[model samples]
Target: MKKWAILVAVMLLAINFSFSNGAGEAEAGGKEVVLVYDGDAFFSLISTSLAFHEGKVPMLLFKDDLAVQQKFIDDYGADGLIVVGRHVDAALPCREFLGDAVAVSLKIAEFFGKSSSVVVMPCSMDEYNLSLIATPIACYTDAPILLYDDNDDEIISAIDKLGAENVIGIGSVAIGNVHLKSEEEIYDYISDIRDVGYLAVTNPDDALKPEVTESQEMSFERHMKNIQITILSQKINLVGSDEATFSISVPDGISRIRAIVDVP
Candidate 1:
């Protein structure tokens, strides 16, 4: 009997997500910022909380049930109001009242014109985390944020609805996975736009420590056929070896790593 075991170790990659010094100023010099959130706790927490914290933009929970919108208008007295989604009623007085997240975002992008971009994310709980991750980009670009989910067919129907063509995605979001890229790539893209410091560190010891390691059996016949494993984009080939031990070398600057083995 021939047995083989492959030990894979990956180091943790740390990237700097610290807020920019003048990020708050990006939202200033325009108007007293008001973010019209859907008022859903989960959605607001992940979507607008960081924007409020980073850009000094106060969030107004826009729910149709509450008639406090007028109070918000009177107290804050915002020069312009930007709505995150259409579900909320816009009774506030403003130069314009836009409907739907996409539409509202487009209205704000008008200020930046050709230099503007929009941040899109899935509306479901699983995907809303990207909103928080991408909030800094939104604040920096002064872009509008739009969210979508699997069920909402109208989610993407409004992407180009407002005539804003420069579109960017934060996490597991795209035009049907056509531009599926790694998270590091997205962060790098944001860094390019903002020119901020990014740091990444890798620690593999914690990840590889396991009580039990899975083993595999290779017969003479299978050994003659050869075996291979693929991790990320790297591949390791095992041919005619009864037993072997090896350590894979991953290049620096790679923010993430994953290992996969296929058995047939």
Candidate 2:
């Protein structure tokens, strides 16, 4: 009889373990992944929104009561929980991933099955205008926005481990070796830098990299050829467009090897 009791206890433990690991499949199957943030705080909301843009998940304002938070998660059928803010505690049945806005974004990106290319924005809400600028950029790039601080060693290491190819810095702040693509001077800089590329437009679109079309008026000349161009570094390929003209500027005795290229 004792042996049977022991066997039943073992089976129960196994079942609990299964539920813990597969909570999404067991309870929230076919539901959208959800992000839980401390809604009372504006900074938390905005920072968490960065991840939401990438995760494409609904946001659930976290309640102090664990039961209330659990119900909210159940109501939405959240496959995963990304808890934002340092103080917010999640006691959900599923896996509870915790981090500040920037750190959480890395987890959210993995949830969406995207490569970890992230946009670095200012950490404080005082730079709200800068954050506003970064939002569309993040959406277009399909990357999470990480708040920047010089001492953010953990965030820096996380980004490195992600094998991130393009780490874009928005606004005036410089994080790491990121070049400011928002300025006009980047055009000249592009030519000088070996692997640098430029994307210019009379009217910029919501796309991180805009599409280039052929321009019949602007034909490629012989001297204007073979200049290497790319979009977001290497994410997209570009070619010359008849709609766009490639003009080369070289000093005396220097050859104009290529005219210009358009991003495809």
Candidate 3:
């Protein structure tokens, strides 16, 4: 008889500074700078993307390394900084927004002015995957994505302040004028406005740690079968294998992965 053990890993890809589109054009006091939370402040992370996009500012991670932050400031010639989350001893003239996730998100939305629509997702940690999906849509649609708690009234007030004509809810949440109940529905809705593709690939244990080439390319054909679709007049193929393996490349980085496989 063959014995089988299944191992699963879910990787939560941290939103890094490299994701920013560079610094925004300078304003009156100085150039607009990106504000980042030093910790796993999920709501702040989602809200900041909208703020940065609307403001057209560059973003950097706020870790214990003040020197790195200072270098970013000097390199960009930034005179003022907008600090998100808790207060920090910034190296430049800065404005801080401090509060819980809901408060912080409301502040960000208020700072950027108003929006015509709002995207609301569950605030609990378990619903992070939904937030991840909703984020890009919010940014692209120029809408604010707020984390909603069933008991929380502040979200309602925040929506009122935004004067949003449309409210979009992800999952089974009670809010939103329109609710997207599943991943496929969310993807389909966004696809109408933009091209979207999702791929999940699994590999055997030995194949997980491929050689870290300068190009950082992994041969998908070796591990998985191909799935294809057409969006916006473009063709996209998603490939995945039956075997499951998981690993993380960054030290001290947060990742979540889920894998299911049969083994002996």
User: What's the CA RMSD for each of the models?
Assistant: 18.4, 21.8, 19.1
Model 2: lDDT equals 0.45
Error in Å for residue 41 of model 2: 5.2
Candidate 2, pairs of clashing residues: 214-242, 214-243, 215-241, 215-242, 215-243, 224-258, 224-259, 225-257, 225-258, 239-262
Off by over 4 Å in 2: 1-28, 39-55, 63-80, 86-92, 99-116, 176-264
Model 3 per-residue lDDT tens digits across residues 11-114: 22222222211233323343646566767546444544555353546666676545667776677776666666666675455666668776677776675567
True-vs-predicted CA distance for residue 102, candidate 2, Å: 5.2
Maximum-lDDT candidate: 3
Q: Which digits, one per residue and each the tens of the lDDT, describe model 1 over residues 1-264?
A: 211111111111112122112223122223343444564533443334224323445555665633776565556554444444443434432333345444444344443343335566655555443344445455455455555454234545444553446666655676432231444554555556644333223343322333333334333323345577779987777765445454555668554556554445
Of candidate 3, the 10-residue stretch with the lowest lDDT total is 2-11
lDDT of 2 by residue, 203-262 (tens): 232222333433233445443333445667764325443244456445575422334555
Which residue pairs collide, candidate 1? 11-203, 12-202, 12-203, 14-201, 123-148
On TM-score, the stronger of 2 and 3 is: 3
Q: Who wins the TM-score comparison?
A: 3
Query: What is candidate 3's local distance difference test score?
Result: 0.58
Give the C-alpha miss distance for residue 160 in model 2, angstroms: 1.8
Residue 36, candidate 1: Cα error in Å is 2.8
